[model samples]
Target: MTGETIGSDSADDNDDTLAAAGEFAVIDRLVAGRTQADAVTLGPGDDAAVVTAADGRTVVSTDMLVQDRHFRLDWSTPHDIGRKAIAQNAADIEAMGGRPTAFVVAFGAPSDTSVSVAASVTDGLWDEARQLGASIAGGDLVSAPLWVISVTVLGDLGGREPVRRSGARAGDTVAVAGELGRSAAGYALLHRGIEGQAGFSELRQRHLTPQPPYGQGACAADAGATAMTDVSDGLLADLGHIATASGVGIDVDRRLLDGDRQAVAEAAAAVGADPWEWVLGGGEDHALAATFPGALPPGWRAVGRVLDGPPTVLVDGGAWAGNAGWQSFD
Candidate 1:
């Protein structure tokens, strides 16, 4: 925490809510003593913050998280929510083969929320941003019936052409970086109310804070990735996007995915669910999956290959018959 008083000049600093302390006072507490990344020329306090785009090309993406819909306050602390917000947005830049440099966040909560709670969320956002050598440049705070966080990320592509979903081609290798299905396994464990095992505990924690493969996006670009995307929506669903966009088919070898299935097999049995479903259909892992010509990159593992046939995803050369991925309205 920043350890800054809510209203240092007022006697109610220790007990003030956002309403009691007022907007400016609470904002001061949230931004107090936080350091900005080198790319952020001017941060929080003016009409808007200035950020450097040294590559002359900036990649930007935004996402919003709603209370009880995207996250449950009882299950996720303000800190976890904040980290999650930053991670997901950063992953978008990474998928484009760019490096994140700055972020802008907007937060909304009830007026009765404690100033300390807001500070805790700020701390989480900063903690996650620091991991990528980025900064929270600016943001807005407002009153709402429940918590809502919206984040916009700024990235630099280092003069490299962006990796896009439409670039995959037949004869290219489909590979992935970082863990798969772990977050879904953790969500299952949490949803089923199972706890106690050390392994299970770790999985549960991953569901709250995903560990996306940072810096690997630029690595994939440098290694000549033809197409890339983060596994936010299940592997099959996400790869299907690439397939459709590239007008090609993707055939995933089940044997290649045994590791991910094995990782969650025990949890699946405990929850009375199929491990393959989590491996093939679970989303929110935020891992990077890409198609590359020639050899794979250092951090990527071959999972499948692009095909000359129809625009669809097939597992073990056939269609999968389970939940393909997550849909907002489903």
Candidate 2:
């Protein structure tokens, strides 16, 4: 896409090709001069970049978004897809109670695709990176049958120990920060073609670009959080990760989440869907959910408490009966 003019003479247009310019040149153009956060020690251009953890430990995670499986060209522009991809990946690092520092993206699409669209996607990636004081340190591009985006993010512990799912003691309180069920609500709004619904715009936008509680991950880590994870696999299923990992039980009080339920209630009614499903069964919200030993950090709201039972997540002291969570094969 580079070196070609808007209506450059045919000679110039014909001269540009992936094979001629090479992958390195394209990647250089994409990554050159971008800034990395303080947390990154070795960013891009290496086998794997090293991220500094205050406690000398790192938190890393990866996510892949396949065309139509995670997004649609009709519903989301390439830019939205790119931002969503990074946001989700960053959320994974945050789930461990760490601050996102850098991202590496691998992009695949048809060769005939406009270089401009690819640039647009990179623009979106950088846009989101700017929000977190992070950088797109490296990336890969190749020809594929459809658009496939994979992102891996590295995070810093900020001197605090990494928060794992296995640390929640029985008495730790469960809490969350950031909006829940909005992405689920947005998906419903889009699928049902519901229009002009009050406060639905934010929900719809959430599906396009999730608002991950950007800096809260570090806050959770600093606040003596026993365990933490982002809400990407629905509230209960994500909690299940902590439960299974820690060999402990979690009980979520439904009453504490009524505010979230109320927030999405109107959109649920418009589509004849259960608000609780959107709230409890929803994923992709990227909200921070953690277990704390005492008062929650400034921004978190208490939702429940850790229990002594077997590894499981319960709502209102019981199992939830709706959809469990999302899986690639399902």
Candidate 3:
């Protein structure tokens, strides 16, 4: 039984599971009344979606989130999971200094899952995609043992050169847009089962859904950013990529990140963990980090400076002796 309300014409299937409601009915509920972006000349119901790349170049990236690996149903709703999936994938496109134009999603879940739940997830995807002025051009659904969400994003560079990770120079300034460490802090609170705190609720919510700094990628590119990347990995780990690719050293001043540490200080105290670790070593925040040749743009904050040396990332001129970031294997 579905036992969930989706506010669709198929509301009668609220108590019906995916197996009972059938695939086409569920898909109709998911795509009904959704408007496509101008870039999407052809959307769902077509054999293939046609997206416009006015610059004659398309930036593409894909990501997959498995149940209990990237998220947990007990802690996140289907809608939250959907938004998280789209947001994370869009960040990759942003990292290349492009704007997302279209997305195609594939979802796998058990047949016993409620149709309403699946519809909610689709709604979440559309909600987030709408924020980027993009559309869910097309997708597929299938039965599986657990919920697996895979999303592929297509973006346009708008005639600008794609900013790569290897372009950072010795004298460039390392800057960042958007907050950090909230996701890790939220995870810590949830893992410890801590609750009813004043501000911790926001942190917990952050773990479920990240708020990436949209539009900042194109802004950074317009400002002549030398190198750019999103903080899907920890700050140190992501910066390490730029350092390695550019063959330059990077030193981050801990003091510059005091605001982030302060934002999670209370949660850290309650959990007996170092906020610095979360601020520096945490991932999934999806913040934009980049290197600029001169003054950073208005929304960007100066965090460090690229150095002339062997490729490495240092915090306060020393190697950070904490968990650097997330790893798929270990």
Candidate 4:
């Protein structure tokens, strides 16, 4: 708690910058208790803040995006990166059938970077925060070789139990509530130097700035979703998470993904790549996926069904033999 500023007290103007202040100094300045949402009992300075849930259940998830590994400064502005980072992390909370209440961020950047860039990044973070009526709450700063952003989100259950991935049973319908494959298509368009294409241009933008379906996760929960997850990884890979977590089998019908596949088909063809790979195997879409026992609520579309037997994810009643999506290590 030492050296942590009390209020809007701006520190001494120095060429020192973030690096000179050191990691802890910068973090102390950033997180020195301002105001917290009613949901957070303890804010920063602890190992982890204690977030209270109405039903005594806490929904938590973490995500890390490396500069080159997850984003490129050449393609995405700092603002876009900030929004995407927050949006994707919040989507994970939605997948658990909860609403994000607070977020704690850890950011690493080069010392020579301008303060304007960091301010733009903060603007993006706050911009996205207002979307869910949440606030930045607390954060940390550190010096690194390249930019690295990590966000941990805390969510409230609103008195409802968390919808875990291991609860989907056979006969449950598989559904999605957000766009799929757009980011991947956009990435392809950018990488291939496809210029002057309207659709590809939109796809490229989606790669830089993803649009997560806010509130849809809680909607699924209220509708009695048995299992759910966000498509941070490929559709199959993410569903595989629910399958293993819930001890159920998931089978995706490719035909059901007709809309998703077609949405990026042209870009795939232009890049001489299979659209199904993006549809079935591409990651970072952050779409909401869940198992519904009845008619899905508005903004959702059914794509498949839960299956009996082993915990696995299948495509068209068979195994999908494609690049199973990206991973930290090959």
Index of the highest-lDDT prediction? 3
C-alpha TM-scores of all predictions: 0.95, 0.88, 0.96, 0.86
For candidate 2, the per-residue lDDT at 201 reads 84
How many residue pairs of model 1 clash at the backbone?
0
Task: Please give the range of 10 consecutive residues that has the lowest summed lDDT in model 1.
Answer: 1-10
lDDT (10s digit) by residue, model 4, range 227-319? 999988888888998889888888898888999989898898889999999987777878999999998999999889998959998888888
In candidate 4, the residue pairs with backbone N, CA or C atoms under 3 Å apart (3 or more residues apart, or in different chains) clash, namely 166-246, 186-203
By the TM-score metric, which is better: model 3 or model 4?
3
Better of 1 and 4 by TM-score: 1
Candidates in descending TM-score order: 3, 1, 2, 4
Candidate 3 Cα lDDT to native: 0.92
Backbone clash count for every predicted candidate, in the order shown: 0, 1, 1, 2
Off by over 4 Å in 3: 1-13
- Candidate 2, residues 56-132, lDDT tens digits: the string is 66667889998878987767876788899989988877877777778888998766555556666888998998788
Could you give the candidate ranking by lDDT, starting with the highest? 3, 1, 2, 4
- lDDT tens string, model 1, 1-330? 122322333334476778989999888889999989999999999999999999787999999998877877767877898999999999999999999999999998888777877887899999999999999999999988788899999999999999999999999999999888998999989888998478898888788888999999999999999999999999999999999999999999989989999999889888999999988898888999999998987989999999996899999999899999999875
Root-mean-square deviation per candidate: 4.0, 4.3, 2.8, 5.6
Q: Top TM-score: which candidate number?
A: 3
Give the Cα-based TM-score of candidate 3 against the true structure: 0.96
TM-score of 2: 0.88
Error of 2 at 204 (Å): 1.0
